[model samples]
Target: MRSIAIRLQELDDDELEDFVDIWLHNRSALYYRTERLGKTSDKGRDVVGFVTDQLHEGDWDLYQCKRKTRGSKLGVGEALKELGKVFYHHLKGEYATLPRKYVFVSPRGITGPLQTLLLNKEKLRTALVDQWDETCRTGITRNEEVPLSNVIRTVIDAYDFTRITYLTGTLLAKETDAGPALSKVLNLVPDEAPEAEAPETVCEVEMVYLDQLREIYGETSGLAFTTINDVLAHPVHAGHLQLQRTRFFEAAAFDRFHRDNTAPGAMETFKKDIFHTVIEVYRESHPSRLDRVNAVMKHIGMTQVSLLGRMSRPPVRQGMCHHLATDGRLRWTR
Candidate 1:
């Protein structure tokens, strides 16, 4: 069996064309294999393959694969270039006896602009859908008829969205059930009360703390008054010390104090000690430190027990440390 990672990596242009061909031919025997018919003699054709029991008579389809990558497109220019080859082969009576069809397989798909360009062209649009339908049916599933609607539905079903909202309406929609539940669990619901009048611009100590919090975490970390208050009240959090001090202190003084009091490796040692202590305390203390933190967080209006549990987990040597470093909760450069 192919690994998922390998399968994901294998889903490039050629594989996609093969996939489409397999789907179209519906060859249950699975003897289908794609071939490159020589760069020089093949002309425009990139892949040539036969599906068993496609037709009572000798019936086959030829496809020109234009596997576009990022920022690459299959425009009218390229389509016309391939079409010219088809015209050349037709004029030479190469496919006079056999039923022949021309196809352009692009994984990224032909853009709307290019589709319009093809539609506007009299010759290209004339039998495009019929030819494509015939090709797909004969190539992937011998006699089965697969509608365009089915194909569209397949593509639409592949996507998963977290949020859905109307641009023009007051109402909002959520695409996933888990999203709303998780949001509610995290206390992220928007207030339904009447919009308060905009406050006059004024400097405040709370605003300064909010800015500091934003700098420490990030703007979207949702550092509200309740979250900050909870963080300060938590005895385990080192930030609690700074919360007690005034916000107007100089950066130099703060840095000097931090450097002088905390030894070079002391912070890491302290962090480890605190982590172990939390785990030991939880294992030994009555009601447990984990229960205490959860209770405290809940008292401060957080309903997410899962988040608290996650926060209370003992730090392992691997993933969590890396995560902490990546998220700027732990320093690595020092």
Candidate 2:
């Protein structure tokens, strides 16, 4: 398979713009709305991120996308021209205020020299001012030259050049949160299942399943089981209770994780599959409630859950029983 950066470099200009819009929505929590300005006369903004309810009047960020061939990097001239457009247009009052950030989005990334200039905010500002007469001044408009006038220079001086940044396809691929968006746009597989180790401390959300287990233990062991400590004191039931809790929490984590990563209702539908698969076994008679629980677990091991693909591990499915039990859907003792 082609690497993510290589694949990104292959997308047409419109595709790249649309993807940056989607990717920004997924990756950033700051924006209330995002738009891809695809028209040629978009006044220098390719993608706009509206940060506040005031929309253009309040605060926004500008994303300028450049789709280069696989090996080529964005150079100082083009970078300065893009920066110039925003500043020149802002001077003409194209929008209410300058953007909170001006980002250069490219698949091939900026050249090493440009990267060094960006790292030093003062140097980048100097480069922008020095290069404006040739690159930005002419390129910002066909009709006239946008000189680096005193007014423009004052705005640039007060403005934080440090807000300028770059995002490459390589940096984007490293974001685990972007996995779903990448899969949707790039047709890549979703990232691998995240680790779901059960926490050592029991959480309040486990109360429902723990209650069921405690009551079931009382039925088999002939004890009152009023408190958790009482149950823990029992040599036999204590270990069993711990294992059940572990399974329940692990399954809970797995369900929460896949729900966020997979398609809508996927995890819910998978849980439903487990319930139907085990409802018959759960209805059968057993010597004790614990025996019934164990039987249902064994049944799920042999059965198949095709909904989640490789994500449906044995422990994850087994934990679904407690998922059902917590919602009053399945009860081992009842």
Candidate 3:
């Protein structure tokens, strides 16, 4: 497995631009609607991300992508030229207002001189003003001297130059959220199960034992127990009622087991295996025909007690015993 950064570094210019678009979408979809601009008509922006408040009406951010080869860095002149486009467009009323942020996206990354300028807002502004004549002046205007107003200058001075930031290929490649985009770009199979937080709640089935007990008590006593308290108070059904109560607390542990085991139908298979294990325990007890139902119940409870050997959940054993007595093939008394 090649590292994501190393793989990203290998992408050509066109692919890198597309990958950055996807990366931004994955990374900031909650806060921004990412838009990719065409190469020639883009007017400088390779991608523009509008804040989620209301399309272009809200604040916006800009991205300029460069796919430079290894050892090549973004020059100061090139950086200045890109910055000029934002100021130039705002002056011409091409934008409603200047972007809240202006980011440079590149695989090769910015040169040392540009990186130093980016460290301090005042220094970066000074560098931009100094280089305006050579790099930005012509790019901002083709025909005549573009009048830069004092108001625009005040806005520029107040503008957060710190908003000018860089996104390196290494950072993009290492982002966990950007995995799908990177995999798409590299033409690799995506991970089937990326790590995610466990859900706060797990779905549950209605109490299986409670339903069975109601059926059993009705058959034995000519009336079904209408409430849980009635079932617990009934002398014949009291033990099984206690077992079902214990299972409610044990639900969280069972849910974790179900989630940890990834096999399909694993929960059903686990229940089936538990039933078989209980049956084996019952058969080994070998209660005699002379044994009454009460004696049989006691024999199973005592002799078959170890059926739950080393099990994490003790309440599960009680539920299994209830199942065996009521519904399982194992007869309480022959």
Number of clashes recorded per candidate: 9, 0, 0
The 0-to-1 C-alpha lDDT of every candidate, in the order given, reads 0.36, 0.80, 0.61
In angstroms, how far off is 218's CA in candidate 3? 17
Clashes of 2: 0
- In candidate 1, stretches whose alpha carbon ends up further than 4 angstroms from where it belongs are 1-40, 49-58, 97-100, 117-334
Ranking by lDDT: 2, 3, 1
lDDT of the structure predicted as candidate 1: 0.36
lDDT of 3 by residue, 1-334 (tens): 7776777777887788877677667657555688888476576678788886665567888878877777787878988878877777676667766777888887777788888888777898988776777877676656666444565566667778988988777777666666546645775433322222223232234344456555556556776677656766788677654544455335334534433322224434445555565554445543432223333335333433221122324444334444444444444442
Task: Supply candidate 3's per-residue lDDT for 315.
Answer: 47
Residue 173 C-alpha lDDT in model 1 = 20
Clashes in model 3: which pairs? none
Q: How accurate locally is residue 118 in candidate 3, as Cα lDDT from 0 to 100?
A: 81
TM-score of 2: 0.74
> Model 3 compared with the native: what TM-score?
0.57
Better of 2 and 3 by lDDT: 2
